[model samples]
Target: MSQNDNNTDQKKSESHALVKSDENGHALTVKGKGRLLALTDSILKSAIASRKANQLAVDDSWMQEIWNWADSFTISEKKIPRNRQMLLGLTELDISGNLLEILPESIGNLTNLTELNLQQNMLSELPESIGNLTNLTKLNLQNNRLSELPESIGNLTNLTELSLRDNRLSELPESIGNLTNLTELSLRDNRLSELPESIGNLTNLTSLDIFGVRLSELPESIGNLTNLTELNLDYNNLSELPESIGQLNNLTRLDLSRNELSKLPESIGNLTNLIELDLSSNNNLSELPESIGNLTNLIVLDLSSNNKLSELPESIGNLTNLTELNLYNNRLNELPESISNLTNLIKLSLHGNKLSKLPENIGHLTNLTELDLWSHNLSELPESIGSLTNLTELNLGYNGLSELPESIGNLTNLTVLDLSNNELSKLPESIGNLTNLDSLSLHGNNLSELPESIGNLTNLIELFLSRNELSKLPESIGNLTNLIELFLSSNKLSELPESIGQLKNLTRLDLRNTMVRELPTSINQNRVKVIL
Candidate 1:
């Protein structure tokens, strides 16, 4: 018999196959059908059609509107033949959110398709035929079970955006290099361990998000993607990067936080366009590359939470444009004098460090607004600190400071001041000059009493004088009408000041551990809420 006759005979045989289950009972069996079993084919297509229609019916009007916009559709159970190219060519196809375990070989026919979103599906693999959709620009396969891609995928030369986030992909095919037109790619929250070496072919890519991946290193070819503007590798296991990364000259934002990186390549200085670089919470980092000084355009740099870092390079002074610099939670004992060169710095956080003293030239940072030196071993501030007239928030809490310079009064713009947990016995009477101050904390100190000038800070809002040896508050305390939260716990005070009742904005008062045995009549009437 001829080939045509043989195919016809086979189709006839499959049409007569015995029924297995008719859960929905919408299909009928035809006699003499072969491999292209008529009953099986119709049953599968109707099942997929029913599923789509059901989903669309239950969806809100917005989704129904989208369904209407999708010009193409799919029906389950039908084997899309490899040669049936004309059967495709639909603009949008929704074969996603289904129980599909395999892709059909006939999907290559959809050359005009613009979007293919198959999210929340059980698809484990894609057919090489999909490469035929050269006109496809957006492909979203998030929340899928796919572990690999076909080499033919590279043929989708027109694809601009691809999202495979939250998938089980372990690796990518070299054929991926063919997607040179791609601009954005997301592999976030996936199990990917490494990226394909051919990924460098995507030179036009602008954004790449691979957060929470298991990537340990990137291929040197990645540096070829100089057009990338944003690169996110947060929460990864990367230990180092290729020196070629410095070639990403156009990159503006780079996030390498929460990684295991111990060092950065000196080549990183080549990224002159970098505006923000986050290397926070990398506990193993011991030092920064001196080449970092080359990033003169950097606006923000975070090296916080690297407890093993011992020092910063003097080259840091080269970041003259730096606005925010964080070195918190480190073991740094001293800063280089070159640090005084960051004259434009606004917020400098060196909190929870082991610093003994600051550079004498620190006063050069006249533009600083917040200076956090909390938990350091600092015993004194340079008299030059009086030059930081722009400073508003100053944190010297948890330090070994025994005395403050009278020059502290020079900070006329000061608002929040934290001197808690220190060995201070007296504050300079000149402290009263900080009239703009709103928050003042002197808790856990050796103070016996506040200077009467404390009453001069009429704008004070939160006052924490707890855990001290104070015997009494001045009658002038009532002048602070803006006082809100007052903590007087763990003190030696014996009586409440009648003036305390004048703080109408007060919200909470703590008298715990104090010698006060009786409350004022007004306080006893629940007029002022106090914790004793």
Candidate 2:
């Protein structure tokens, strides 16, 4: 009886296993059992396939040859693939703006890399292995905290362009001269106090920027780069240039501004091909070499802010091709008549000088577009000034100008005219002929009234008449419909002309300390800010 009961129970258990129940405890049919078995097999196959695909991806990731981790990539050695073939095939790697504080030494394994950009990072030092990138033609390490470079950096002989700007580097490795193929090198805004004499070995260099360095002198070997066309040595402490600099006959532009240079080497005149030269802000520069006249090709020359520069070489006239000449803030009392020979001059600035008069032939520069003679002792301008019909901007403020030449009316193209802080008791009626003037400054003057013809300046957007003796404004003042700013502060104006209300575009009306006690009802107080 026990054997029979055991066999029956085993059979019942098998049957129950083949059936399934719904939430309500239901039994399954044969077809349903078959369907369930097929579904389970399909799920197992998908799981196995997905696992294989994931494994394949992991295996192939190491074959990637290009890596661009700009900004979004996190620095982690474990995340980089370690395959040798992948490293050898990688030709470009950019990790700019990644805030990377440290680069892995293993990066040198990418021996085939031609371009590497690590700009805008926090890196203070580079691995010595960096020199191993002999195939690299371009490398940018700008805006980093590096104070020095590995001497092995000179090993990158193939480098043509390298930027180390905005770093703390105080000196460069002499081995850097090994990059004979370098055409462009930038070391701007670094702490470098001197350049290695070996730098002259880079004869192929055409552009070299060493701006904002502390260099007091350049090596004579620099002249060996006869192929150089541009050299920027601005904001340095250089007091003099090596005479050998004249050997760079190919130079088209040279900047020695903001230095302590007291004089220039006569050999500098040998650079006959120079097109632009800047020597501004050199407080100790007292004179220029007479040989400077040899630069017949010079088009732009800036000698501004050199307080000790009392005179210019007479040979300056040889630069007939000069288009711009800036001599602002010097001690020159007069200009050489030869200056008038520069018919190509487009801009001439002589402001903040002791010049009592300009060359009588200054008017010959008909091509002049801008002339700044402000802050000078000039009491009168040559009538020839009016001959500069092409002039659009003229500054004569902070001067002893008691009168203007009648010929000034001929400058029909003038858009800006500044005559403030002068002894002008009256303005010539011809001043009204400057119909294109957009700004007219007459503040700090003795004008008690404006000429009625002033209304002819319909394009006037700004009119400065503060600190003047203007007791009344002409009715024509309202004719300046485009005027947005009217300065009448510290004036003797006791009342406003009803025509003043015609200035529909006026937004600012300065009347502080004026005699006026109230505004005219015609004025739109809501739109105009009246300063009392």
Please report, in order, the local distance difference test score of every candidate based on alpha carbons.
Answer: 0.86, 0.90
The reply for model 1, stretches above 4 Å from the true place, is: 1-110, 119-129, 522-524
Q: C-alpha displacement of 63 in model 2, angstroms?
A: 11
lDDT of 2 by residue, 190-248 (tens): 99989999999999999999999799889999999999999999999999999999999
Q: Against the true structure, what is each candidate's TM-score?
A: 0.80, 0.84
Question: Where does candidate 2 have its weakest 10-residue lDDT segment?
Answer: 62-71
Among these predicted structures, which one has the highest lDDT?
2
